[model samples]
Every structure is written in C-alpha cells, then in structure tokens.
Target: MKQVEEILKRNHLSVTDSRQKIMQFFLNSKGALAHADIEKKTGENFDRVTVYRTLQSFVEKGIIHLIPTKDNSIKYALCKDDCEAGHHHDNHVHFICDECSKTICLDDVTVPQVKLPKGFTPQHAEMVVNGICGDCK
Candidate 1:
C-alpha cells in the first residue's frame, strides 16, 4: 500500500483510496487486467463506474498502458517507471496465452520500427503475439 502511494506521488497524481487500491491491483497483477477482472478483484467495495474512471485516470497519467486483444477487449497493464506525463515508452510486445487466456507484457521483446510513407506520422503502435505460454506448455 505504501509503495502504491509512493508510485502515485512519483507520477504526480494525488493519492486517493480508490487510486491506491486500483494501483495495488495493477502492481500485484501478473498480466494485463480487464474491467471485469478489476471489479471482481475489488469485490463490492468499489462501484463499477468508479473503477472505469480510475482506469481512465491511470491511463492518462501514464501509470498504465492499454493492451488491445484480438477479440477487441482492452486490458490494462502497469507502465514502466520511465513513462511520464503524455509520454509512454512501453513499446514492447504483448503475449496472450491461448491456453490460459492471459495477456503478459513481453518486456524483453520490442516492437519493430516501421517506416511510414511521406506525409504520414506515427503516434503509437501495438503488437500482440498469441500462443501457448510456458506454464501451459
């Protein structure tokens, strides 16, 4: 809990009970989390709308990054410490285990650079690999 508070302070975000609980959830998660996951983990203590707003705030604060799955359901994962306000360097690939349906951040594998046509500017990119995870295999 203290660590979560410090993280919020470091990120220039005010520490709130909801934020702390939500941040702690992210810190303890082994992989990306969806809205339902969060709500289930938090139980009946937090309202659904509050959880959604908290996630939105975390994403805007760069405390978390969005992971888009093949089914179009988005998940959230903790961002690296270097990520700052309006800037996120989590360019690594996301791995979704087919067996367990878990989405993990592949920090060691970075996304390849792409050269765009003239007059085009790239803002962000995402790469996700689906396969059987080591635990499943």
Candidate 2:
C-alpha cells in the first residue's frame, strides 16, 4: 500500500514484500498479534525465519512494539507514538480483554510513575490491565 511504503521510507527501511505484507497485517489488525499468529497469517507467503527476522527489524525500526501477556508469550502491536529506532515512547498501559482475549494499547492511559528509594534509578515501566472491553460491554 502507499501508506505502508511511506512508513517504510520514513523509517529508513528499504521496502520489501515481506515487510509490506507483515506491516500491512499490523496496520489492519485489531489488536496485538503473537509471532505464531503472524506466521499463520503469512505462512503461504513467507517462512518462519523470515517472519521472525522481519519482526526483529520492525522492532529495531520502532514500527512495532512487544506486549507482555500473562502466559509469558509476547505479542506485537503498531507504534502509535513517534517512535524512533532504538528509542520508543510507548509508555502507556496495555489492556487485555477478558471476554474477547484481545490485547489493546490504551494510548490515552499512561503508565503510573513509581517512586524509588535514594540511590535507585528507574529505567522503564509498563502496566497491563485485564478486563472486559467496551466492545464486550
């Protein structure tokens, strides 16, 4: 798609079919996607390693981000913020809908700041809320 091409150019990543299809999947997605799910979606077009490598490159380019799930499996979602390579400002809470089991990025809800004792430093913080989404309610 034209939009996908522009995003790839803006990110300074060369346009490729693998990247295009994978990125499109994220673009049209409703919520976070697991690696296996992505593979299943693109299995006929790409191999497992290609999908994995593409995901890693996308993360490095800040096109997508990782979401932590309760079962320990990671998921990917598009970066709504102005994320740059090696630097991302996706400091917001993620929501997991209990009814539909979808992972959504609550962009308007930011993660709460935590207080640390003296001599301690904080690098990053993330929050995941599990509930029924508005769609389900």
Candidate 3:
C-alpha cells in the first residue's frame, strides 16, 4: 500500500482503490496478462469498461506498457526497471508461449543495440518471440 502511494505520487496520479488493486495484481502476476485474463482472474465486480479505462490510464501514465500478441490481442505488463511515471522504457523483447498464450518479459534478452542509417532516429522498439515456455513444454 505504501509502495502504491509512492508510485501514484511520483506519477502525479491520485491513489485509489481500483488503481492500487490493478497495480497490485500486476505486481503479483508472474508475467503479462491480457485484459480479459485479468478480469477473469480478479473475480472482481468491475465492469469491462472500467477495466479498460483503468488500463488506458495506466498506460498513458507509463506505469504499464502495451504488448500486442500475434493474434492482435493486447496484453499489459509492468514497466521496465528504469521506467518512470511519465517516461517509458520500451526497448525490451517479449516472449509469448504458444501453448498457454502466456507472455513473459524477456528483460535478460533485451534487443541488441542497433545501428541505424544516418539521419534516422529510433524512438522505441519491440521484439516478440513465440515458443513453448518451460511450464508449457
């Protein structure tokens, strides 16, 4: 709860039950979770619209990041180690398990620094590797 307050204060957002609950859920989760998966697992009475709106707010605040699956479903994950409230660190790869549709942050396998041609600027990058995870294998 104190951590949530600190996070909210740093992000310029007010601490609320819904927001705290949402953040705690992610912190407790083993990996990334889709919106639908969260709703199912939380067993809370929050409507889908509420969840979506909360997720949107969190993403906009840079407290979480949006990761899209190959099938186009959007998953939400906690920010990277260096991520702050208003700024994001999106230079990491995501690993998606083909068997269970689970997504894990491959922080250890960060994208290698790339050398782009001159006059090019890279704002962000993401790589998705699809395979069977250990739990599913």
Q: Which candidate comes out best when scored by TM-score?
A: 2
- The 10-residue segment with the lowest total lDDT in model 1: 79-88
Preferred candidate (TM-score higher): 1 or 2: 2
Name the better of 2 and 3 by TM-score: 2
Alpha-carbon error at 99 in model 1, in Å? 0.7
lDDT, candidates in the order shown: 0.83, 0.84, 0.79
lDDT of candidate 3?
A: 0.79
Tell me how far the alpha carbon of residue 99 in candidate 3 is from the true structure, in angstroms, after superposition.
1.5
Candidate order by TM-score, decreasing, is 2, 1, 3
Q: Kindly list the per-residue Cα lDDT of model 1 for residues 108-129, writing each as its tens digit.
A: 7889889999999998788999
RMSD of each: 2.7, 2.6, 2.8
- Which is better, 2 or 3, measured by lDDT? 2
Local accuracy of candidate 2 as per-residue lDDT tens digits, 30-76 = 78999888888755568889989989988887778888887988899
